[model samples]
Structures are given as C-alpha cells and as structure tokens.
Target chain A: MNETSRAVGWKPRGWDVLNIVLLSLLALATMYPFYYIFIYSISVPEEALKGVYLIPRGFSLQNYVHIFKQDNILWAFFISVARTVVGTVLTLLCCTAFSYGISKRNVPFRKLMYGAVIVTMYISPGLIPWYITMKSYGLQNNFLLYILPGLMVAFYIVLIKTYIEELPAALEESAMVDGASYYQMLFRIVLPLSIPVLATVAIFNAVNQWNSWVDNLYLASDLKLQTLQMLLYTYVNQQTAALSMINSNSTAQTAFVMTPTSVQMTITMIATLPILFVYPFLQRFFLKGLMLGAVKG
Target chain B: MEKTAPRKRKIEVPLLVLTVPFFLIVVLFSYVPLWGWSIAFVDYVPGRSILESAFAGFKYFHRLFDSTSDFGTVLRNTLVLSFLHLICSPLPVLLAIMITNLRSGRFAKFIQTVTSFPNFISWIIVYSVFFSFFSIDDGMLNKLLYGTLHWIKEPSNLLSDPRWTWWFMTLATVWKTVGWTAIIYIAAIAGIDQEQYQAAEVDGASRFKQAIHITIPGIMPTFTILLLLNIGNMLNVGFDQYYVFGNALVQEKIDVIDTYTYRVGLLNMDFSYSTAAGIFKSLVSVILLFTANFVTRRTSGRSIM
Candidate 1:
C-alpha cells in the first residue's frame, strides 16, 4: 500500500497520536505494576527488591512452594473455590428463576414479587442489622454464611429480567402451544437461550464471591473456613515479622523460607488467576449485559 | 376455532409452586431481618431476648450525632470521597471514547482487558500492588525516582499520608473498575444510530465536530441514567477495600461510613449505635434514589423505577 492510500484510511493525526500515547502510557502504568509484582514473586527476594525488570535474577518456584507450606492456605483455597462454585450456582438458579417468573405477564402476583425484589435491591437493612440477624440465625463460623447471604442478588435478577424481557415472546408462546408447560417452557426455551446472560451474570457473581473476604472476616471467626482473600490479608499483616525471622537466620536452610513479600504476591496471583482465566471467555457477554442493565435503568 | 370460544383464566399452580422457593428465601432473609430494625431504637444484645432488652428510643441515634462519636469526621469523609468519585468517574468515559476512536481494534481490546484485570482481583491484591509500588525501601515508584535523582533519603509514604490516602483509594478504585465502567459507555456510544453521524459529516462537519454534535447527544440519555443510578449508591463505598487499605496514619481521611460502622459494631461492640448509623446511610441512599428518579422523569422523560 502506498503511504497516501494508507493515510487516506484512518491514519491518526497529531492530537490522535497524543491520545494514543497517553492512553497506552496509562494502560502500561495500570498494568505493568501487576507484572512487576508477578515477576518479583518468582524472583529471589533481595534481587527482586533491587529493581531487576527483565526477569528474575535467580529464577525460582520456591516462593510458590513456601506459600503451599503454610497450613490452612490450601484448605482456605479450597473453601474459596467451593464458595465461588456453590454461591454462583445457587445465585444463578434462584435469581434467574425469580427474575423469569416476574418477567412473565401471566405469572400470579407478579407485581408483588417484582416489588419485593426491587425493595430488597434498593433498601438493604444495613450491615449491622444483617450481621446481627446472621448471628441470631447461628450462621457464625459456618461456610453457609458466606454462600447464603449472597445467593440471591436483586440487581442480578433485574439484569436477567431485562435480558429475558427482550427475548422474543413468540418463542415461549409457541413452546406453550406445543404442550410444553410452564416448567417445560422455562427449561427448554428460556434457559437455553439465556446462556449468554447466564454466563455474564455467573462470571460477575463468581468474581465478586471469590473476592469476598469481608463477610467471612466479619462472621467466620474460625480460621479453617476463611476465604483466600482473608488469608491474604493475614499474610500482608504478618509479612514484617516474617522478614525479621528470615533475617535472623543466616544459614542456607532459611533460603527455603521465601520472603513474605513474595508470598503476598503469590497469594494475590492465586486469588486472581481463576477470574483472569475465565474473563476473556465471558468478557463480551459481560459488557453487553452491563450495557443492557445500564440502559434499562 | 371452537376451542378459543371460551378463554380460560387458569390458575398458575405450577408457576406459583416454582416461585415458592424464591419467596421463602426472600422472606427468611430479607423480610425477617427487616424486623430487626427495631434494634436501632434499643440496646440490642445478640444473646439476650428482645423483650428483655431496654427500649432506649432515639438514644442510639442521639449518640451517633453526639460530639463523642467522631460522627462528623466519618460523614465528612464519606461525602468527600463519594463526591470526588462522582467527578472522577467521567475520566473512564473519556478513555473509552478515545479507545473506540482508535484505528487498531487489537490495541483497544488489549487495553480493555488489562485495565479491567484489576477489578477481578480483590482489594487485598490491590493493596499488595500498592505496597509493591509505594513501599518505603523496595518499591518501584520510590526506587525509580530515587535512582534518577536523590530527592530524599527515603520514599514518601503515599498510603499513610492522610492528605493523600483518599486520592490513593480513588486511584486504586479507578484502576480496577475504569474499563468495566467504560464498557457500558462504549456500548451506549456504539448503539447510537450511524445515520446521524453520516448526516453531520455530509454537512461538512469535522471529525471532532461530528463527535461533539452527533455522538455525544445520542448517548446523553445513557449518561444521565448512569449518573442518577450512581448517585443512589453514593454513600456505599467498598468497605472491604477501604478497610484493607486503611492504616493508623491514613484512617482519618479514609474512614468512610461503611468502615466506620464495621469498626464501631464489630470492633468496639457498639451494636445499637452502629445500627443507627447504618440505618442513616440506607435512608439517605433511598432518598437519593427516589429524588434522582423524580428528576430524571421530569427532565429527561425517563425514570429508573
């Protein structure tokens, strides 16, 4: 292609060039910090601290191994995983079912159900009251506390309802005319076409649940059931003391004890990896879901 | 044709039955706990019977606004932080617009993915990232500045400085959710009819002029709706992130309403007082939502309700 032909297309001008540069710079600034930390996690502690940018000076898996060495870290990891899976599935089933019901014109007491859901969304009984109620219900120190409270989010329901409302009513009508009952229509017609939205809500909810440590920190006094984020918090707070202990021992045996900073990064990576892996798969749907929700609101 | 002669009003038993679980869950969790709002008026002890508890009507609320409560500082922090976010939130909109204007689709997608990567990671991870960049000794930010020029003996404690913590919180928050927020605006812009832009261009408008006249006006409704919706949640700062990021040095500036409630209720065991504060926040949110909805209906001919 000739330069003039290329320029005739969308070759950016002066201001556009500046915009691109500034944007890329900001993107790098936002992104490369995490990359630096990721590299630091795998590098030897001292060298990592010395501003080595290319790669870890002395490459190692010892940091990840040290994180694995801690008791309950693995258990907390599993608990977090279990919480994400169970909480998301439950949220999907209940919220979607309720939303589907409310969206249908023929559903009984639809207005009342719709009002209840909206009320729940807009007027939460505040944190303290909820905490007190959870305590009264004897949910303290239990895994159910984390999973149950977040199982049915109203905003997610509204999003799903908005999406379902846009779906062609003729499909459901045709299914019903063919002797498919309400349940049959729901499962066979509604659920099948709702995958894009289901995946979108599922990914968003899963990320939220995985990152939710506050509920556990508030309710679960038992360390055994703490989520990964809570464990990471504990790790951040204890890093200084850990560093001192490592410095005290000059022997090579202590080299195996990875720096707490490295462990901190690893914990962050571990907590974030699932979402990162699942994001691209669901990104397009999520953006669409959010736009529809925003526009409808 | 004869089958349609009598339109039946059939009872939806299966639908009702199918919806029973939703009602049960809502009643159990939402409606039942709603009754616990009575605790705001009394000295609510978790283990004690509700009947036995002393009914100190308005006493806890009085304490919340009293001089001893540090209530002024907490409210001020929440308002300032939220107002600042309301202003700063538009930066992401601009970023999204700029990215969409770019010629390279691959670059736009890459920017979107990486910027949103932070949102998936919890505040704990953000805190760790902050430390990596701002830690006194080993931080890249400090090291790079120090290496270039010996400005000071040690790196400045960016997170600990009360004057700077709120901005740090905002930066961390924006870093995480900017792309997520931008995606909506981008979609809204995308949805604008292309014929309008063509008309503007055909009328001899420049690219910038076309954007200003055609594109922006088209997405005005989306912008207004989002603005109103965001206003509803103005007081609800991310408690987990703030609590994780806060420390002794920066607590004064960063201690928002949510964190304040947690500290008072869970840490100090002042349940009744904290409940009052929490109720106050929720009440404000409800009012904002209603007011915004009213304004939107009056001006824009649309309503969130």
Candidate 2:
C-alpha cells in the first residue's frame, strides 16, 4: 500500500501538518482537565487555594489519607466491586444461554422470544414506569436491583446470538452425535467457542455496572448500598454546595489540611482510576463491540 | 444428522427449561412496565393496586398540557438540547476523517486512545473534572482568566450560570462522546473499497479531495442511521449529565424530560403526574422512531428496524 501510494505520487501537504497540529490541540484539551484535577488533588490544600494550573506546588497525600480514613468510601468501593463482578457474571450467563437457545433453528417459540427481546432495543416504558415496576418487585434499597434488571440486556443477547449463529455448525452437530446434552453442549462447546464475543460483552457490562449510579441514587437509597460512583456523586453535590457557601462566608476556611476541593478531586480520581487502569487493554473490545452493534443494527 | 433427529426432538424440553426462565425475566422487567403506563390514566395512589386505583381518566395527561404545568419549560429544554446535539452530530465524522487521513499510525492511535478515554468514566467524574477547571473561586479557568491574565474583573462560575447551561452541557456531551462515536465511522471508512481510493489517487487527486469525495460519501449511510437514531432519542436527552450538573440556578435551563419526570414522580411523590409525563415522552419517542425509520427506508432503501 505504501509503495502504491508512492507510485501514485501522493505527497505530504500543508494540510497534514495542520491536521496533526489541530488534532493534537484537541487531544490536549481532552486530557488537560484530568491532569489539572490530578495535580490539584495532590497539591497541599493551602497551596491549591492559591490555585493550581499545571503541577502541584507542595505535594501532599493528606487528601488521600483523609478520604481513605472514611469508612463510607471503603464500603462504597466494596459495593462497587461486588456489583460489577456479580452483575457482569450473571449478565454473561443469562445472555449467553438465552442467545444460544434462541440461535437454534428449531427452538420452540424462537421467533416469538427473539422478537420480544429485539422490540425492547427500541422502546422503553420510560422512567416512572420502570421505577414503579421495580419498586413493586420490592427491589428498592436492594442490592439485587443492580444485578437483576440488567441480566438479560437485549443488545448483549443480540451480539452474542449473532456470534453463535456464525460459529461452525459441525462442532455442535458432532457433540450432539456423541449424546452431549443441550446444557452440556452450551457449557462445553459453544460457550468455549464464543469467548471473543463474551469478552466483549463482559467488558461492556463490567464498565456499565461500575459506572452506573442512578440505580444507587433512586432505587437503592440505603447507605450501605451506595457504590463508588454514587459516593462520588454525593460528594460532588456536597462540595458544590459547600463551595458556594464558602464563597459567601470567607471565614469558613478550616485549619485542616484536607480541603473540600482536594478531597473532592481525590474522590473523583478514585472513581475514575479503575476505568483508566483497564481501558487501554480493553479498548479493542469496545471498538469491536461497537462495530458488531452497528452491523447488527 | 438424520439419526440424531429423534434425540434432538427429545432435547427440546430441556432447552425450553433452560431458556424459559430468562424469557420470563425479560417479560417481567421489560414488558410489565408497559402495564404501568395505566397509572398515567388513573389516580395512582402509591399503596393501592394500580387496577384498583380510582379511575380518573386522562386527568393527569390533561394536566401535562395545562398552562400551570412545568412541562413547557421541560419540553423546551429537551428540544433545545436535542437540536444542539443534532446540529453538532457531524463532529465525530469530521474527527474520523482527520484520524484516518493521518500518515503516522502511532500518532493516530494515540489521539484516538486519549480522546476516547472520557467516554468510559461516569458523568459524576466529568462534573468533578469540570468543576475543578471552571469553579468560580479557585477553578483553573477562573484563576487563569482573572488572577493571571486579568482579562476579567471578577471570577465567572460557568457551572452556575443559567444562560450558558445549554451550550455548556452540549459541549460537555460532545467532548465525552465524540471519540467513541467516531469509531463507528472509522469502521465504515475501513469498509470502503481500497480500489476506489487507488483510482482516485491515480487520477492525481489530493488526499483532501479523496477524503471529501470518497471517505465522506462512504460513511454517509452510517451517519444517516446514527442521526436518525439520535432523532428517535430526542426526548431522552439522558439523565446523568443533566442530573449531575443541575443546581438551583441552572435548574430551569437544564430540566429535560427525564429529570422532570424524576423530580415530579420520585422527589415530589406525585406518582400519577410523573407517570403521565413519562407516557407522553414514550409515546412521542415511539412516533419519532417510526418516522425516522420511514425516512431512512425511503432515502436509503434500508430500514434500521
């Protein structure tokens, strides 16, 4: 391709330099906010008050130490981890089994079930009804609220089903000939072969479960059920309110080293760090998942 | 295969047993909510069964159109935000074209990775990061504008200003989503025939000309499909971004359909009114979806559904 382009006399132009420069600026704009927050979170509270733009002036771990001392933050972190692990596992199992069953040509009521599932991809009953229905199921303030309603996501089912349908039919046929039960075939042969799609779905669901806080905000109001996202949300609101109050009353400053701004930025980093850690490795799956979704649509 | 047909028939029951539970779960969670739409039509008391509630037919629905209701402001906010989003929808396509045009593969990959990072984090974190940058007193932007540059006499709180809320929220949404959205267009661009590009190059076309003539047209179908889907989702301006950014000062400007429903239903305990608002939103969404699908089929000879 490079030789062909060269043979065609394609040469670098001024637009290439302009494009690279402009996109680099855009990337910088996207990244600068996170960098600013990280520096502010690490700066000494008193020094940060003078303002932090690029780098920390007097480095301190006081904000992190203070937030780590808070039991609620620890508990929320635990809840977030628990929900992501359980939610992703349950979603993968249910969606995989459901998709596998529906992928078969002769499953009873296959079209009807598939149609029902696909219809949900376009229409939602809106927020009030969804919340009311969940409340009626006694899911309010329950941890099950996080995992139950999400288990059979229609999009995941469609992705997995499309993958299953594309697999070589001979493997399943051979397993059947050996008298492998349907469950055994699904767990042993098809599930193993569907790892790529499953990995894609797993990453999507895990990120979703970790990042979601609306359920924790609305359905599960119990303090113990708060996830890290919810805790960060509450802190954001609290800090905003407090900042306004401090603006009005200049005497509200405390002698403590852990300022609300520092603590808030710390919590924000805590909430985001996990995704940042996993993102580079899992990004290809996200791209593949998007293409699969687009193709399916 | 023929010999195992009899055994396959016998296995059907177990298959049904394996899948039926999931089917039931989907039905209960997804379809049963449709039954809750009835609450919009009646006087829905919280403890009472929806069927047993007093039959005040269409009272709350009428209230949605009543002059005293907040629905007007809510609808205005929803439409304005959706319109802003629709007008800016081409940004991702432009980004995709630029990324694909880059000669350095490593640089293109780095930019894609960095830009897409924001999409993975929660809106709460977005709010936090924005606050650190734009907060009035010690915010980075304020510090630069007032303290360092002396460009402004007073620190401006972009987060709290109602006038800029719509534009600010739209910018935030675009920043968060543009890179992720571009991935679809990138995939579409990849699917374009390589021969077409070679032919264009052989004709002494500049890279810019090739991109304009070939790449953009190649992704137009994908772009149209996504745009139509966005139109279908116009009423759903999403709950998280607005919810996290909302405050008393900007509440009027940022209260879209979803947040309005939440406030009235969950916060105020006005279950019936909220359900009515929800029903209105859902009905309009379905209508818009069908209309978009119709337009797509007419224009492209393909249907999303």
Top-TM-score structure, candidate number: 2
Docking quality tier of candidate 1? acceptable
- lDDT per residue, candidate 1, A1-297, as tens digits? 254444534633765788789888878988787677778878886666667565776888776776666557778899999999999999998888888777766677788877786778666777777887888888999889987777678778888888888899999877766778777877888889998888888888888888888888888989888888888887777787745553454346665655667767778778767877887866776767766666766
Local distance difference test values of all predictions, in order: 0.79, 0.87
- For B229-289, candidate 2 gives per-residue lDDT tens digits of 8998899888999999999999999999999999999999899999899889888988998
Give the per-residue Cα lDDT of candidate 2 at A279.
96
Q: Looking at model 1 chain B, which ten-residue stretch has the lowest summed lDDT?
A: B1-10
- Model 1 bad stretches (over 4 Å): A1-12, A100-107, A161-189, A242-255, B1-13, B147-153, B199-204
Residue B296 of model 2 has an lDDT of: 96
The C-alpha RMSD in Å for every predicted model, in order, reads 4.3, 4.2
User: How close is every model to the real structure, measured as TM-score?
Assistant: 0.90, 0.93
Q: Residue-wise lDDT of candidate 1 within B169-258, one digit each (tens)?
A: 788778878877787777778888888877765565655666678767877787888788788778887587789888898888988899
Task: For candidate 1, report its TM-score.
Answer: 0.90
